[model samples]
Target: MTSSTHPFEQEEVMAYLDGELSANRAANVAAHLRECAECAALAEQMRDVSVRLSDWSVEPAPANLTKNLEAARAEHVVAKVRKPRGFTGRLGGKFPFLRNRWVWAAASVAALLILVLRIGLPTARQESRQSEGLQLAYTEQSRSADTPESKAVGTASDNFKVRPAPPALPASRGSSPKFSSSSADGQSNPEPTAPMIARTASVSLTVKEFAPLEASVKAIAQRHNGYIASLTSNSPQDAARTLSATLRIPSAQLESAISELKQLGRVEQESQTGEEVTKEFTDRAARMKNARATEERLLDVLRNHTGQVKDILATEQEIARVRGDIEQMEADQRSLQTRVDFATVELSVQEEYKASLQGAPTATATRLHNAAVEGYRSAIESLIGLGVWALQALPTILLWAIALFAPGRWIWKRVRRTSVSQS
Candidate 1:
């Protein structure tokens, strides 16, 4: 490695004979060996060592190794013949010759699928429960306008609650703007909500664009002093969303709001209903007055009466009853206020847009093309699923496939003979 020494020194000369010298350095060694008898003798000695070691040899391989590999193949063939024709077996590649095993696996899958289709799939218990819950919830919702029991609780919290009933229509009408802000409370002078027939109207529509409709609908509802009640949106075939929302706007804004909503999209469906609760309202008015009169008498007794322990307790009880009655009446008033302040309109909106499609409303050729493409995609996906399932059950499927198939059955017997004979 050093630059100072001759590369073809005697040791280098010997290394050259051993073929261990670097090519360029070996050339130098070869030249030295040629010029010096002593170095050439060293090279001769190294060559002699190599010649003596060349006599070493390894033992020959056994003749049966090929036979063993072949036997394994034959046994695999036999095993394939004996297994059951189950889907898992058909798809599994545990056995040889089941490389396209997904077919059997798919067959197995088809059995369960066939059963499902033939019998008609039963609803999942959880889904059934949820449906029942929604039905019950809807039923409950329908009945919860205002109630005598809820009104009797007698608290400020009652003002925030919604009760089951047709809300009382205020005497004033057509006073509030489409949408105008309230200071949360009446000011020096405030216009009251007008008496109007309580009603519910719902509409379903499909729009090519959703954002504009969303914004416009929201604006209209706000203009009407309404809030969105509920919403849901989803699209299975396209990257589009269907939106369903219930907007609660002031009854005064009803007509304008409906017109604006209609302008947003082509209407698919529409329905409306008006509910009358005049007699019910009248009955409540009378009951409230009676409660007030009872309460006044109780207050008088509390202020003026002095009696035994039992008498005082009895009077106190009456006072509590009257107070409860008064509280109930106040709760009813607030419920009526809410109904008078807002109206409910349920709307369902859908956007129609699919990126994969070309222009709208074409002929059957386009439909056929799209359907065929979709069908092909579905088939490929099904095959892929079957392949995966077979692969997963490969160990088990192989056992069966080998037992059932021609090559697999042949290989199976061979494997059994070999394994048994070897044992």
Candidate 2:
């Protein structure tokens, strides 16, 4: 019906009948349907059509059609499954290199060998060149020295094998510091630099006099131009007093300090160890060089940036990060240097104790109380242990019982039958 003649349009009425309209609109349509017979009749006809659609059903497909669909599906699946693969595809599914375990092992070994050679060859060549240079320098120095004093020094140099120092690595800001190889007379005096070694020593002693032991330990450290890192002293009421201290001493004076410490008491145990850290120091120095280079590049970028604020900020952030890394690495280098410069000594001293019959013994009541407490603790522990065992073994026990139940019953029944038959 036209909207001019009716309050609701035909589409609105149909939507109301289909329950698609909002609640208020649907209520108004219902009220209008109750008052207007013609609109109500039209709504009734729409509802009747919807009811017919809801009840209607399509006929099932013919049996041959179902069979034909099934056959088509099977043919498509077969075609997909039987698709031909290229040589590369087949090889990809089963790689030739993976077929034999020995091939993988051989390849791994070859790669490892190549890596070792690559890393070792350059180092070996550098060392050889350094040694040759050192030898030639020694020869020149020996020829230059003709005086008796110089001759004696030259003969001494001949007996020693001079090792050349490694090439100077790049520093953070300035050039690496150089050591003068010439004497005050401007004559070359080649002295071999020793490899860096961090020394550690442990000494145990039994002292007769405990009064001066602590002072002696401290004196030993001070004498060697070192400091006590940690010290712990325990003096029991009736037992021998003990003192333990960890000391850091100049490696040059380590032997002397250890000998002096041994004289303070009868030596019970003594041991010394050294760890070479030249390579470790070299590696860290190289890394610091690279980090400093990165920081310098970032600083340059930050200074020359004519780009957006964000780009400048990002560059500044990167510079800050690199600077932080450089500082941390510098601190690490200092710590490593300290280790090489100092030797660690672990000292333990015990005072000699003589037993005397003057001290009072433990009371009987106190001993009885301790015994009772220990007994209670033992009983509780035993109970806890039993509970734990049961918890751990219950499942296994139940499983075995279930598994053996049937066979056990069969065996019992056969035994009873045999006994009855014999009776």
Candidate 3:
């Protein structure tokens, strides 16, 4: 048996020593080792090292150590008897390092509450602002409508306005302006109450007939003077296309379109929302109008002022600046107009097909192979997870378990032994 032929690797030999190799594999290794002198000698050396390492010992504990241990045992017994159950555990947590289970539990609850507040507060604020805006809209609508009820409401508003109006406020406030969407108050009186914001509706579903549905959706979009901004369908599990598209439909037609889309498939999930951009639209329109006015005045100065070449150049520059402003405002106006004309519908489409009940889940051998592979992977993963946790937590777990459970177990054993002796 030469090292060149029958010799095994260190890893293989170690695995065999650990009893990890299967019977057939281990038998092959053993047969090979019988013919391999170097490997047999190496195995013998490993055994010697193991035995030599096992020969070390520790000194015997002193008699005083025993006495001290007895005293410690007595204290532990007293603690077990008098330990204040849940309250003690809870109170212990207050001492920073000293606090144990109850403290951590309370802290966890407190942290959870803080997290909820952190997450939920902004949402609550948003809801509150929405509600307040709605209320404000209703108020402004009544003011603009100028009904008898409005007159009564106006009286209350008049009293409110009597609080020595700031110079920034317009003398005669017509209706609440949408620009007042800011956190600031008394900035501007809003234009006649904005058109009520329409509700937003969206749906995500899988449809086997998605290709056909896409055509229908496209047709609907065009009929309503809307356009599809995006559409995509790319998936293997689907024989029919998967469509995720943002369709721009008139706000008025949004609900109707969504209903039609739902008719095409079983809706996996659907949502409806309302956002009042009326205020934003109104405010932007007002600002753009003011900017245009300023721009026009600059242009007028540019045309009429035929002064020095420098002044003419400066005037032209001013006109160009004003024109730029007008262009920007025009863009803003167009965008707002588009929003009023076109509401966005975000749709997610999937194709679901009914299959033969008896013929479902074919390919048994492949499935079994996959199952075996997954099982092995899962076992390895579980073993690694256990090893990691044990390595990380064993000391702490052992210490606490010994500190807490050991005393009780010792007392129980002592009592049982005494009773047996008495018997």
Predicted candidate 1 versus true structure: per-residue lDDT over 237-260, tens digit per residue: 656778888887555456567778
Query: Distance (Å) between predicted and true CA of 252, model 1?
Result: 1.4
Which stretches in model 2 have alpha-carbon errors above 4 Å?
Answer: 1-193, 361-423
Relative to the true structure, how large is the alpha-carbon lDDT of every model? 0.57, 0.66, 0.59
TM-score of 1: 0.39
Clashes of 2: 0
The candidates, ranked best first by lDDT, are 2, 3, 1
Give each model a TM-score.
Answer: 0.39, 0.43, 0.38
Clashing pairs in 3: 92-99, 93-99, 176-190, 177-190, 205-350, 206-350, 207-350, 207-351, 208-351
Cα lDDT of model 2 by residue, 1-423, tens digit: 688999999899899987999999999999999999989999889888888998888788789998998898797754444433653233223343433558659857975785456444543433444464432122333333354533341122232223322213111111111111322232212121324566789999999999888888898787656778899999988799999999986555577788999998899999987777656766765566566666765676567546567666766777788788877876776676677556789999998897657768999999999999999999999999999999999999999999999999999999999999999
Mark the regions of model 1 whose C-alpha exceeds 4 Å error after superposition. 1-196, 235-240, 353-423
Best by lDDT: 2
Give per-residue lDDT, candidate 1, residue 386: 99
Give the runs in model 3 whose Cα sits over 4 Å from its true position.
Answer: 1-193, 196-200, 208-211, 237-241, 353-423
lDDT of 3 by residue, 1-423 (tens): 343565557667667766889998888778866877777777777778788988887788789998998898897755454545552233233223333457669756975785456444543443454566332222333335355433441122221111122323322133232222322342222232334343445788877665587787787666555578898877554344577888876554565667777777888999866555556666665665455555555566556545567656755676677677767755665566455445678888877755433546758999999999999999999999999999999999899988989788989999999999999
Worst 10 residues of 3 by lDDT: 153-162
How much lDDT does candidate 1 score? 0.57
- RMSD per model, one decimal: 38.4, 23.5, 33.2
